[model samples]
Target: MTITPQNADDSCLINQTVPTGVMSPPSEYLDEKKQLPNQNQNQNQNSTSHSGEDQESQKGRSRSIEDATAPLPSSSSSDRGDDNDNNDDDDDFPEGGLAAWLVVFGSFCSMVCLYGLINSVAVFESYFSTHQLAGYSSSTIGWVFSVYLFIVFFFGVQVGPIFDRHGPRLLVAVGSLLVVASQLILGLCEEYYQILLTYAVLGGIGGALLNVPAYGVIAHFFKRRRGMAVGVAATAGSVGGIVFPLFLQAVIPKLGFAWSTRIIGFILLFLSVIANLLVRSRLPPSTHPVRILPDWTLFKDLKFTLCCVGVWFMEWGIFTPLTYIVSYAAAHGQDANAAYTLLSILNAGSFFGRFLPGFLADRFGRFNVITITNALCVVTILAFWLPAGDSRALLIVFAVTFGFASGSNLGLYPVCIGQLCDARDYGRVYSTAVMIGSFGTLTALPIAGALLEIGSDERQGWLALILFAALSYAIATSCFLGARVLAVSWRVKEVY
Candidate 1:
């Protein structure tokens, strides 16, 4: 007999026919008593029971087969629902697209304006100490930049939560205005306090506003590719680092400090416009009002605590070289032009170093790559920088190598922090980490400058400072290793 199965959708046709031979006896009918010879009776009863059991088992199997092959209304619908839910979750992350990359580009421009000015601090420091603040000791002059650096990170504590609530638009816009204003007004300042208020206080606040959001917004757009995205954005700072110094070197001789700064202000104005247009947040703002305060409770996480400590020491080591490299080169008898050129070279190397480690961190692990680079920084400080007294080539080599190694610290530290917390809390966590590290930045230059005064000879003073930097990196490396070990076991092959 031929039979046609019903489709699941055709539920209206409820009645169906079965072939005549397909029906089975009821259990009671099959079990009814039978008479026979004693031995034959036993065998016949066993065969009857076995036949009934076989038919029952076959029927159960056929039902299971039909259930497996045919789709049920509720189950099939629910399955589709689950798939849709998963798709919705995935759709929340754009991952990679034109809009996403535009955010990245906008971040890049913002960083160029923010960090570019930051990276060029050495130029300002060098120029100011010699010209405007010539009467002050190097240690005293260090306070201006130190204060600037301190406020930049310290303000992040408050700015981070604000970014989470309002998004990056207003923060970046205000930052752009403040930074441009700082530069434009900076050219007109002559007194120490005027310079301090204009450059240190104003610029620092602007930078804090710009810096946190530039790094934080990228977290909104990318996850797996975050390191690469951050790296690309960070390279803009190094480019600014290279360009700003060269720009100053070229124009300062002809236009003097005032007009040179104004030209830079104009350049920053243009960059800020691009940043305002493109930099945007992908995630929605928090519904509940968040306190614009640092969550000190984050210290509860040992990894975060350790990461903060590691960053503290790393920041202590990093800025000492950046702030003092030009001064150190000049003190060691290098020509004025060459001494300033060393800063450019360091930033030039940093241009590549910023992105390369970022790219590598995505493939390897963030902590792993940062730890290696931090170790290299220690080696460069002690091995190359310390012994290179008056050696132009060694100073150049140290600048380049140290720049390459230390550049990762800026780009990778945020990525490392992101690894510890949710993306939504990244701004708060990262800003807190930076706030902690700000103390290091605040004290490192002044302390290094004081150490410079301690030595009777300039060489001895520099040696003390270099050793201080080296020791800081050593501590940073240890903390990073501890954090890594806590995150993943000692197994070297683990991808963590």
Candidate 2:
């Protein structure tokens, strides 16, 4: 008698499709079912008293499933401990504690190195266009960041399983080494190919390794408050985004591109050390087999599948503004400081955007909060950004509001996926969805760049990108609404 992910027998998983991806105990995994009293323990013990070894094993297995949320019993526990223990801490997430907070801090530091750079990619795009790869077209230069983002998310499918099996230590260590090297080498890169290798390939892979575990470790520490915990850690991205651009502005002129990048590498080196020391998981290693290949069958659940599509569209829309805002402001005849300031303003709004919505999501429901944020994203892009031209006031307003609306996208998407899957499967399920969304990240900025190229003039090209961004968000909003309606069956008041 054995249990594996392949043989999940929960009534919710096998008997029929869970419409909301939720149900009562023994049949579903939800926040409400984290702890339960085992009503059948006495009957199971009595029935197995004189039973043969196989019967005893079978009895233990039954008790394990029926009382899955209860503490693991002494008899035959090891045989199926992985399945039970995986959910053991679903209810046990320390709402607040020193060690848990330390892990959050460590994740924050990791994100500063990972997403922090991601948020500042526009600076690199601007610099490379004017400096090292000046000969390349904007579309060609756009490939660098697009490929970088693609690697970070696409390799997430592999990183998630490895984190589940082995934890984050080795992954973070190797990732740190690679990321540090990429930054150091990037300072020396002048050719298109060298920049591609160092920034896109090397940096991207390192980012993937660090990003998943940084998030997975947080998932290990907090469940009920995961949205907020993740949101807080995610603030490091905005913080980094703000810090790096300003740092680059000051240092790039003084130290030149080479020394500025090198200094950033040193900063990442310092942060990585802190992250490695503090980040560790409380949960025991998962015994279920790791599947590097995605489980495509999960998409059969239409709600979950649509959620993935929604994220795919989200990246396409959100990244365009992030990468182009600096250039857009510059095109309006702003100085260097003014241009970078707008990007900083966006990141500043994102700082509040992550934790505030996360706090709201915990009380309001992840799906509900994210849908509102996405709608806000559509409005800000269309109403504020599309028409904001040379007017500094309008551009500043657009940057702040759009950044707020899209800030929750990163933190809450994982929270939404968590609501749809078993606690134990969060990492894998989330990474798979990200992998599918990687295609959008891979092409988004490049396509926007190409659109910029197509216009008769630079302003016309940017106008086209603005329209594309709004349309992408509009489509994404509809997909998310469809998923929510399917999950809650038109009950808009339902907390999801």
Candidate 3:
């Protein structure tokens, strides 16, 4: 990772994909130029003196045209916004177009269907504990959501390759069916095992199927504008987070769980229709299709290793607040409606958090912006969330501030990964890192719930959960900074 000055391409800056220094002309071309002069000299000596002057002028013109028309470095072309073949090379990405914007919109809809429900896990967790799955330990209840999250992330290992080799239409179509089916089935589950199967297992698989393609497709259409595009797509998660919870809160009492879930299923069906229509691969299939397997050799690079680990700890920490924010409010004496409202307010802040960071990350450095956001995550959790006891205002402020800071976890992580390697290798690397991070999601909620069991009282359990989340984010921040230093040293202004 310690690059020398002459090796400018070794720098991890976002768009520095090719060499910047002037290159020497090929030796063969140099020799041809050399032989042309010698041939002219020989001809003049051998009795072609009259035509020598004309030949010399023609040679000079030929060399001038050769020098002028020679290809420059790929980095220069990329920066100049030159559009090349969409199928030929990742460097040839069309930065934006009507078709590309449609893909982003489709991705937005996908996020709303998949991640939206994830954001509403708190509503389900709280409702199940008090109603259908009453008398269950928090740990048992936590598994339902954890499994959903783990599958959402873990299954990308396989989906990424399939999307790379086969394209996204089939994957999105099937995923849409499964996701809609899971919701419709969820309406009828009255028992614990039934709920687990419908909501967690089935929904998890469906999410994995669609979610990977939503992200993987974007890299096909963009490179320079990727962070902004991803940010815009990711905001749907927050929109879903806010909308699902509020809708459930308003209607769950009036219509009950069965009817509420059925309505959500119908809503998802409409969105999936859009995703199926618009999301697709603009690039052709990979020439050497990457196998559906993890590349163990990637760990050799210290920066990438840290990137993977940072995402793991990020998943471990971030979901704690998102999953338990509603429950915490209710446990601490907030009104039932106010408790659900807190989740909406939190996601409202997240709406901006996801959106603005990606736009900023594109202008500033991806690493710089992400590192700052992770730091904010740590500071907000320890400073505002951990200390907010029964004070409604403090909890509300924590919800908004922490939500804003943590929203970028999904929005910008892949962009940060793009900083580590060339665009051609991006899909594989991102999928592998996400697969590793899935372990953290699988275990985080259950572990947080177990921490609840160890506490003597509800208040102690809540504090322990808060402390765990804060510590995890602190470690994740350190890892991100470590990766940043390896990539760009201590230059805070360098955009990676």
Candidate 4:
């Protein structure tokens, strides 16, 4: 029977056939006239008319049933056309513009609030576990901060897709509200579970929501410059890390944790507002009804997969030092006041760590910068931190140097992953890494706590932490090298 398939495009069809049809020569008689453009059009129409008869003749004569059940001409043609249309759509994007850069700046500010405080949580944890919450076990108190961090990255599986579907305005707005609430309630959290539920889980969710949008919005506006833009934006988190610790150090003693945390929350609220105003996707929401779920298929990308593994190891051990350094100092030998100052010094080094290496990554390669810096971190822990006695000068050197190296690790991971995937898939890739890294944060501190317990002394615990940092960095270095091998082969001289 004759069939006319769906015609979705306005262009004249170039080819056609019936489902059962055998291939045929042009029906127009072979003549000089056939070469004319006008004759070609006439031949196309005549071929359409003969389609059914051609199908029947071919079906009965052909030996293969597969030939008889072949696809229809219009269906095949339309499929090709549709594929082209999708490609065209995928190719369309705004790589960079004034408004897009502004959005990047806005994203930077949002990250400062969401991730900045998070980076400084060690300072908070060290101080609180010793002072106000000194009654709580280190492991128990750790749970409070772990849950906070866990939520920040864990819930992005849903939040990311939601941002893709609805844009950042409402998502960021809600995050702002939740984050502010977290800070307000945090002031009242005297019990362990209250802190866990309020700061760890609730604040984490808020930060997670804020984070995906913070990075995802920039992806919408850039492709070629995505690395630089995201690196610059991400540096704000470190800036926040730097600023908040110093800010808190000054205020917490004077104003107290409740008022200090509230002030930081207010700062976050202001940044989130700016983020809501600026962060935007250039394209409309995708028409396909799909949930934004973390696809493990990302592992198929060898470089990306290795990078994720490296990040996991880096995060797991990175926090051990971050959370324990102040406490370690205070408990072991240094004055409490001096110990707190160490956090500020670490963050100060981190400020340049996050920014300068990012600029360097653009010139070198993301993996190259990450591996070298991470290796430096491993060495510093082994060489400097291990032998650090009550010599305040040595500890200061270790903190600043390790802080700088660790800063490079933070700034480069996302940029490296962004290199691996299409701009649109960045949120999924980023969140997946964050999701996996969350577990690292959840366990690193507790493990240090347990090690401290093993020795019945804070000094032994500090030794375990130094060991953890050294080993974790060693693992990270391996993973990064593995990724480097995959990307540029064994060419050790390659910049990537």
Candidate 1 vs candidate 4: which has greater lDDT?
1
Once fitted onto the true fold, the runs of candidate 1 whose alpha carbons sit more than 4 angstroms away are 1-91
- Stretches of model 4 off by over 4 angstroms after superposition: 1-96, 284-289
- Which tens-of-lDDT digit does each residue in 1-496 have in candidate 1? 3212111111111111234464443433221221122334455456545654444322101223224324312212222121111111122346678998899999999898878888888899989988999999988888998899899898998888888788999999999999999999999999899999999999999999998899998988876567788998899889998999888988898899999999999999999999999998866564324666767777876767888899989988998999888888888787667777888899999988999999877666677889999999999998999999889999989989998998888999998887665465667778888999989889888998899888577778888999999999999999988877765547464343
What tens-digit string does per-residue lDDT give for candidate 4 at 1-496?
A: 2232222111111112223443333334122232344524555566667766654332211112233233223222222222222111122345566887899888887788787887788678877787668898888777777777777777876776676667788878888888888887888788767777788878888888888888788767754345567777877867777788778778987998899888988888888788878877765553323455676766665666777788889887688888878877776688766877787778777777877877666545567778888999988888778998787888899889888888777667877766555444456666777777777777777777777666776667678768877899899999988977765566554555
- Score each candidate by Cα lDDT: 0.78, 0.79, 0.77, 0.69
Q: Which stretches of candidate 2 lie over 4 Å from their true place?
A: 1-90
Q: What is the lDDT of residue 148 in candidate 1?
A: 92
- Each candidate's number of clashing pairs is 0, 0, 0, 3
lDDT value for model 1? 0.78
* Deviation from native of the Cα of residue 186 in model 2, angstroms: 0.7
Measured on C-alpha atoms, candidate 4 has an lDDT of 0.69
Query: Candidate 2 vs candidate 3: which has greater lDDT?
Result: 2
Best-to-worst order by TM-score is 2, 3, 1, 4
On residues 1-496, what C-alpha lDDT tens digit does candidate 2 reach at each position?
A: 2222211111113223323433344434333332455555666566445444444233202222233334422232323232343333334467669999999999999999998999998899888888898888988999999999999999999988788788889999999988989999898888999999999999999999998888888877776677888899999999999999999988888889888889999999999999999998766565447887987877887877888999999999999999988888877888878888788889999999998999777656677789989999989988898888888999989989998999999988887876665545556777888999999999998899999988578778988999999888888888888876765556555554
Residue-by-residue lDDT tens digits, candidate 3, 1-496: 2211111112223223334453433444232233243434454344334444533322101122233224322332222122211112324567788999999999999989998988888888888989998879999999988998998889888887777778889989999999999999998998889988889888998999987788877877777677889999999999999999999999999999999999999999999999999998865565436686777766777777898999999998899998888888888888789999999998999999998999877666566678889889989988888888878899989999998998898889987775554444456667788899999999999999998778567878888998899888888888888986775566544555
Flag the better candidate by lDDT, 1 or 2: 2
